[model samples]
Target: MRHIDCQKRISLLVDGSLDGPAVREALDHLTECPDCARAYEKMVSLNNALTNVKPSLADSSLASKVKVRISGESNSAGYAWNFSLLKQVPIWALIAILAVGVGDMAGKTLTETLNMHDTSHNLENLIQDNGESLTDVLIDFGQSENGR
Candidate 1:
């Protein structure tokens, strides 16, 4: 086996997972190659160090405390206002209705204040004039308006 392949198998050998003819080949390579032998030694040392470590939890009742806190928050009645009736109504429909009502009232007020008839014709003219250059529109508007 190549020195590189033997180096990789060292970890499997350290973990006792390497088997059959592959183990013999890796061991033979490790004996002849100083670098592969050093790699094998390091792998063995690392495996032994990791195996000797024991982990411990800081709080034994942490899981139960977290569950109790979550349940208490869900059941708590701290809210002063209830929006159940508001939730039952469609909020978007309400907003659209109010917007239409306000727009109609403002349009009527503007038309009355302007003392103008044929609002649709005026709206069409404005739309058509928007397609022209600003200077041309201003010149036409100036010529058509009565002296003020």
Candidate 2:
């Protein structure tokens, strides 16, 4: 087999997972190819070292410490969601929007009132210029409608 193929099979050979023919081919390749031999040696050393390593026990307070940190993080995330993009908006901009809305409503009301006042003032001027009382104008309007 080629060096690349041998390199790929090195882990399986080190773990004793390869079959008889595969094992012989890998070993023969290892003896002949220096690069493959070095790779095989590294894999064997790593496997042995990992197998001899003892798993360390966790501290008794580790679980409680992790739980506390998770709870604190969740609470902070909740707070962040609560204080959203709307909260980041400037107070002056909100006040300006409110002021503009109120001003628009006030201006509309004033314009309507002024229009009503102007209509009444024009009616009064018409009556004074023609020297006609309110009743006289109404009677003339009635007669004109009847004729029509």
Candidate 3:
């Protein structure tokens, strides 16, 4: 077997999950390859160390507290988060309005500045296309309004 193949089998070997033939092949490879042997030794030592570890919890009520929080039985801490978010709503709204207003003004100013030289010629072209100038259209609007 290849060195990498033997290394891959090290975990299953440590867990004692490899069958007879595969175990023999992997052990043969490990004995022939120093790298595979070192990998196997490291995995075995890590497994042993983890197996011997004991969980230490200083606060016994910590689990019960977590359960209460998850069940929503105790909500004193939850309200502070909700109330703080609610209090910031108006400030956020004002900031959004200010952003929109500034954007609109900047857009208008940029367009007007960029199109300054073309404005009069563009208006005349538009006015002439439909047989109506600005003054003629305004007069027509006035006549209609008077009729209304």
Candidate 4:
């Protein structure tokens, strides 16, 4: 078998889980390849060390502190909305409303301005078509008032 295949089965070999042709092939590869032999030795040392290690106990007060933090009882301030003040308001909604208001005002002003311009232009055209100046029209109106 290839060195890679033997290396993959090294863990199973240490655990006594490999059997039959696989075990024989892995053993043969380990004997022929110096690298595979070294890897197998390291795996054996690691397994032995892990098996000899004893489990450790945590601090007695660690569990109580974690429980208090999770329940929010560690602080006396009483959970006063932990988020930002600006987050309470819908800022985009207000901005959209203001934009619509400004647009409406602009539209109204534009319409009024265009109407005034058109009125003045029509007045000027009327004066020109009648071949009369401002002074002549005023004098005619005054004469008609006096005759009345």
lDDT, candidate 4, residue 52? 98
Residue 131's lDDT in candidate 2: 71
134: Cα error in model 1, Å: 86
Task: State how far residue 80 of model 2 sits from its true place (Å).
Answer: 39
lDDT by residue for model 2 (36-97), tens: 88898888888889999978756768888899999999999998888886798999999999
TM-score of 1: 0.39
Residue 85 deviation, candidate 4, in Å?
Answer: 50
> Number of the top candidate by lDDT?
2
Error of 1 at 143 (Å): 99
Worst 10 residues of 3 by lDDT: 124-133
Question: What are the models' TM-scores?
Answer: 0.39, 0.37, 0.40, 0.36
For candidate 1, the lDDT comes to 0.76
lDDT of each residue in 1-148, candidate 1, tens digit only: 5656666788788877888887897788788888988988888888889889968678869888999998877666333124555567798989999998788678477667455558767777674756788788778778778554
- The C-alpha stretches of model 2 lying farther than 4 A from their native spots are 58-148
What are the lDDT figures for the candidates, one per model? 0.76, 0.83, 0.81, 0.78
lDDT of 3 by residue, 61-83 (tens): 99998897777844765787888
Clashing pairs in 4: none
